[model samples]
Target: MGAAESTGTEREPLLGPSQAEATVQPVTNSGRVYGRRWLVLTLFSMLAFLQGMVWNTWGPIQNSAKQAFGFSSTDIAILVIWGPVGFIPWLLFMWLMDKKGLRASLLLTVFFMVLGSALRSVPLTNLQLRRWLIHGGQLLNGLAGPTLMSAGPLLSTTWFAPDQRATATAVASLVGYLGAACSFLIGPLAVPAPNDTQIVNSNIHWDTEQIRNRIQFVLYAELGMIAVLFAVVLLYFPSRPPVPPSVAAASQRLSYRSSICRLLSNMRFLMIALAYSVPTGVLAGWSGVLDMILTPVRVSQVDAGWIGFWSIVGGCVFGVAMARFADYIRGMLKLIAVLMLAGASLAATWFTLTCLTRLTHLPSTKATLYTSCILLGIFINSSIPIFFELFIETVYPVPEGITCGVVTFLSNLFTGLLLFFLTFYITAKDRDGKKQDNAALTRGLAKQM
Candidate 1:
């Protein structure tokens, strides 16, 4: 969270480089394997996906949600903000995942997710109560966000071979992005934009009653999926493998205090954390407000949602391919990360130009916009596995759970803080600006009379 402040001399005893290896138990590669590792990966990925889906329920359906719950742009932003708000208590979750191991954290994750999803599905008629329940549900769901994402590396370490670790992490970690992608499609398709011209008010397009009914339908359907996953986790999920899968998996890790001390002192980890967190944070934050950002460019909700869907879907496909590449080539994590960063920067620049073209005579086509989204998504998102691997390798013998959790927790915190202001500066301010423009026009007409 801060620049490296401790000197090497001061850091050495607090589980620095010299002492860090001492914490790890001697490890051996074993021939024994479990047939159930794949199932465990599937469950981890699925829970993460569901958590991501819950986080994004509003972004793709902002208009309908506003109508259904009497929400302002600010209110919608708050719900998205909660996606990262779950990280404020990052240490607690990290300790649970790291010290308590996978099953304890997973148990808590299911509990929070069930309560969160179920709260939203309640058929409450009171608008205020409905809003409260949704927000509360988001908060509880948010609490699970850190564990959902960070568990991938831990799960892989516990259940996968040395050769398969990075790939396993990639498959589990990136599936959450897939969950986000699915939500972009599901939210809009399930709660389709009304074709009717009927207006509920100055801003709302669909009837609140109709929108509410559809929203409940979506919530109930998603809740059914949640119930299924909850049952799966409760019935048979394991804390970890009975035997270590690889040498790295068997290492003892430093205590949290020592790990934090070493991490804060290590300049390389600091750089990696920054490189890993900031861009991803911005990407996640923007997804929540994409509808509002695209409105001025004449993009519809369905189009925006699909763009989001492709962005994430393309990224996941590209990520899986690149993870295999990284695994095959070895030691190219830094190169891969840098190249993707450069490409992503260019794609983002082009994407920004396409969006701004709406203000110019040469407005870009939808094809240009969609292409930019795909390119940006693939370039920026494809490197996630590399970064996760880099983080793990950079700080070996440090527990993978906390290592991933710390970086991801920082990313989520950055996102929540970013969206909080984005709501004020972009979404809410834009709405106020429109009202002011309308008032100014009305006054000018009155003066003319």
Candidate 2:
């Protein structure tokens, strides 16, 4: 499928593939596309899936994680926020990819992926110790975030032809999202939310024998899967295809610094980046804390899990279809992007209104809540591939890895800030409530006097 040529109106100077590539035994320099590229894509997509699964392990199971580990909402937010924090060294990893190639960068990914799960799977009775170990594991996993999140365009460009790049990128990118979707179900099913919280040091800490055991089981399961993936990738995956798939696949790229400068200066690309980041970031942040947000509305953790799972799954279904549509008619990129963004905006507003617990006049039904969430997922998640393809088209001759990397970075940054701000707001609300309680008690004492 990738061997077919892309039909479009474009002009370009053809400079062939790079010179400094690993030319292994039993391979030729012919630029013919190969079927094995799909296999490579499948493997890379698995990495995407597992890494994303690891990242979201704590979010959807908010009550479960809290009940099992005695975690605060702030703690939960901090755990889920690690992915963005991991991107601090993203440029260093990008440098590794550019110099050491895709294979080395992916190795770093699998290493962190498995290692993080391993740490989380450790059995420890002391709550502080167990929580710290889990934090360590999450931090290690965070180190893998940039590659797992940003490498979609790079992987697709490396293996697939031009005509299939958009769809390929969509699959590679959204598969991680699918893993995230599955996480919503897996946590809820594996570990049922317990009815009681264990009190420790005069504070309410959610923990029970059953809940803790189930949480450990979930961690162990993830570790086992990641270990298998690591072994498979190490044994078989290659850095690049034996032959280039297309002109873009084979073509040399601009320097990393030069590409960043060009992207930074380009107004069109910046607008696209901004458009892509906001809703995407908010939805992601919102989803990560879905249980927390919906708790005030009386939604159970299990129900929130289902909502996240189906919403993302539905979005992925719509996203893949839209990606194919994007491929079929490249000219309609702008219109399609506009329509999806508009739909996403309305869906987000609708979901917000439906979730408002304090608004006495708003219609806050579970039915409307679910519908709005699903619609948000479809419209927001579907735009990812479109934006990726658009970025590459807008900044031709720049490497796909760099462009998508920066794009993903912006989205993660927005997500991180939103998570932090929301957490802070919640914490401050608790403090204010405590202060008012103390003031009321003081007034009662004065009246007795």
lDDT of 2 by residue, 1-449 (tens): 22234433112313334553333222223234557778788988988888878888888777877767889888888888887788888888877877788888998889988888888888988889989989989889988888877888888888765666778889999998898889898988887775531122335333477777888888888899889989988898888875655566766789989988999999999999999988787777778888788777777777888888888888888888998877767577778889999998898788777766478468788788889888989998998888888888888778878888888888988989999899899889879988999999999999999
| lDDT (Cα, tens digit) per residue for candidate 1, span 1-449 | 00112233322222223442433332233323366888899988989898888888998888778767788888888999988988889889988877787988998998999899999888887888988999999999899888988888888878876556778888988988888888889988878565432233536455668878888898887788888998989898988766555444555779988887778888999899998888888888887778767767778788889999999999999998988777667767889999999988998988887777646545588898899888888887788888988988888778888888889987887787789887778666778899999999999999999
What is the TM-score (0 to 1) of candidate 1? 0.88
Clashes of 2: 0
Per model, state how many residue pairs clash: 0, 0
Error of 2 at 310 (Å): 1.2
TM-score of each candidate? 0.88, 0.89
Candidate RMSDs in order: 7.5, 5.3
TM-score of 2: 0.89
